[model samples]
Target: LIITIFYSTDNPLNKSAITVPQRAVSTFDQQDLSINMHILKWKVTLEMIKDKPLFGSGIGTFKINYLDYQADFLQKNPGYIKYSGKAAEAHNEYLQMLAELGIPGFLVFLSIIFVFYSLALKYLKNKHNNQNRLIVFGLLMGITCFLIHCLFTFPFHVPVLGSTFFIFLGLSVVYIGGFGLSKVDTKKNIRIKLNLNYLIKKIIIILMFIVGIFLIYTLVFKPYFAEIHYFKGIKYYEKGNYNDALKDFKHAVWLAPYNGRILHALGSTYYHLDIQDEAQETLQRTKYYFNDRNIFRNLGLSYKQSGNYQEAEKEFKQAIYLDPNFTKAYIDLAYLYATQEDYDKAIIEWNKILEIEPNFSEKYNVLYFIGLTYQKKQMPDKALEYFLEALQLTPEGSPIIEEIEKEIYNIYKDRLNK
Candidate 1:
């Protein structure tokens, strides 16, 4: 079916108008097959975990058991395992709950879905009102889609997806419950009248207002606390207290896992402590969490410091890929090449830097390195040219000027003696 879809020919739907071509039809068929396979895997997964429908194995344990489960399944049913190499998940909502949380969790999960569906059905039957029905229908469809998608993807295990799913679930429950209650209340003699005691009414209103404000503050302004911790981490970083910096940054990232800067800071702190592996892992995680070019640069630096030159080069390139005009990446790449004695590659990187920022303040450093490279390559005259350029850029009595002058003197003296 997949092959037929991908290789199918297009035919005109009408004599006057264009239709989906055979190529498109084929592609669609292939895609349809892939989706079907995904759905089938999810179904099999659900059936496998049907017996363990309550209180799942435990939170975050599915992946560990997934391989073993797949191996056992493959051993018993070779036909099913032939299509896909391995099954990593049960792929069904109830199965995921059983594998991770255990039977109880699965039951609760199913109960939540059952209640939602029931409420949705009840709302549709009574609320013949179009607007309310539309709202309920939309909510029901959204929740249904969430469950269906969860079968193929571990959406419930992913932090963002899980949180979003639960939030939507809560919204669905509130709408369904509120709508049902409002309808029931309308038929009852429940008179919601204002109290004659003004003080009591004022107190109730104040309490409600306070509660509303607290909710807003907690959800909206609570992030500032994480930001405070981040800044404290920065202070610790500046003081070279890596352990404390790491702790604070970890807290900040824990509080705001999406913060790229915090992750980068944590990675850097780990790098300085000479924990190269940790630094690399943290920085990689940072990249996954955020797409900031600075993190790539920091990652490159960490790799360079750890003597992983190839990986460092890759990360520097990635940084440049993310931000072409990121001057620091160019400089770092040049320095990295220079450290490897690949003067030609180093020059190429430096030239790139010059192209991006013609009057880049670091030109002297590049010139000085170029001179050193030429000297290493046994081109004294060419090396002298770059040294002169570098010296011209340096201030009088600058250490760079002093160093270049000494080199020039030595070169000249050696040439004359020879």
Candidate 2:
């Protein structure tokens, strides 16, 4: 059971890996992605559980199959995709257990918890006559608190936190003498003895130790190492070192094959290097692990760069279909249209930004870009209208102020020349 769980949650995709829609009201200020959200987006998780209510989608398969379930849910309720974020773990641990292990497995899990508490109560009663009662009670309460926390978070999925849980459990087991106070434990200073009298017991202990080492190495160290490589790749990618980024991303993917975020990054880097075939192949592979608009947007960019305008248009539209309020996708789609010299369609797409009303900072860009688009179509009056509107919102002394004024001048100058 420990081995199975270790294999299951080895790595969780970063929450921001999913390109969720943001309200136009959110500040464009830089903020960390570690969202302190308590609400569990359990609809897709429930769907997965319903699909495999018996033994589950299989141990360690939730991350693998999560995207498919999300895709189906979004297809049926397209409007909900904007509200959805990528949940690498069902925030509710028990529901995740049910999703991964099914009803029977969930019940068995419940039974174990029930037994732990039942024994804890009994142990507490016996400990009342002992000096270590306070310590035992504290440990029990800590365990209880951790369990309640698990109902809303994935702390136990983290190695150090998870280890602390078992450490508490282990201390309790030692304090309770497995079930109750032992004869020796009745003494003031109770101590646990390691009695390996039987050959079988010795063999079992040895095997357990070996398994523990293997599990720690596989579950704890490997994922941590994978995260190191992934973040290093991100840093390199941001620094415009595509080769170094690709090298590290490949290392990350190799370390944790199931992590959708790592795969997505790798595909994106390929897209950046103008390796269209590799980019498409990698992003196509990424589709299997993550269901989000970002991958589609990236794919659209790859296709556009490769001169596949039709395919590029489809991918961008698909991204918009998945997340209507995703300003980046809307922008990308508008650019795609503009590239095809379909100014009307490009204007239509850019006009959708007005409907979205992205933040003040973003709105200015949208208006200015639309003005540019109109200018490209030789509609000076319409272009000037949008340009003036953009200028009104521009910051004092912003460099873009000059740019906008120049565009306005260009309109007047072009008309004079005519």
Instruction: List the candidate 2 regions with Cα displacement exceeding 4 Å.
Output: 1-37, 58-84, 123-136, 177-229, 251-259, 290-292, 321-324, 375-380, 396-403, 410-418
Model 1 misplacement above 4 A: 1-222
Error of 2 at 391 (Å): 2.6
Which candidate should be chosen as best, given TM-score against the real structure? 2
> What tens-digit string does per-residue lDDT give for candidate 2 at 335-397?
989988999999998888777654645687788989999999878899999999999998887
Tens-place lDDT per residue, model 1, 275-371, is: 8898999899876545566777888998999899999999888766545567889989989998999988987887787777778787887788788
Give all TM-scores, in the order shown: 0.49, 0.70
CA lDDT, candidate 1, residue 353? 75
Clashes within 3 Å, all models in order: 20, 0
User: Candidate 1, overall lDDT?
Assistant: 0.74
lDDT of 1 at 53: 52
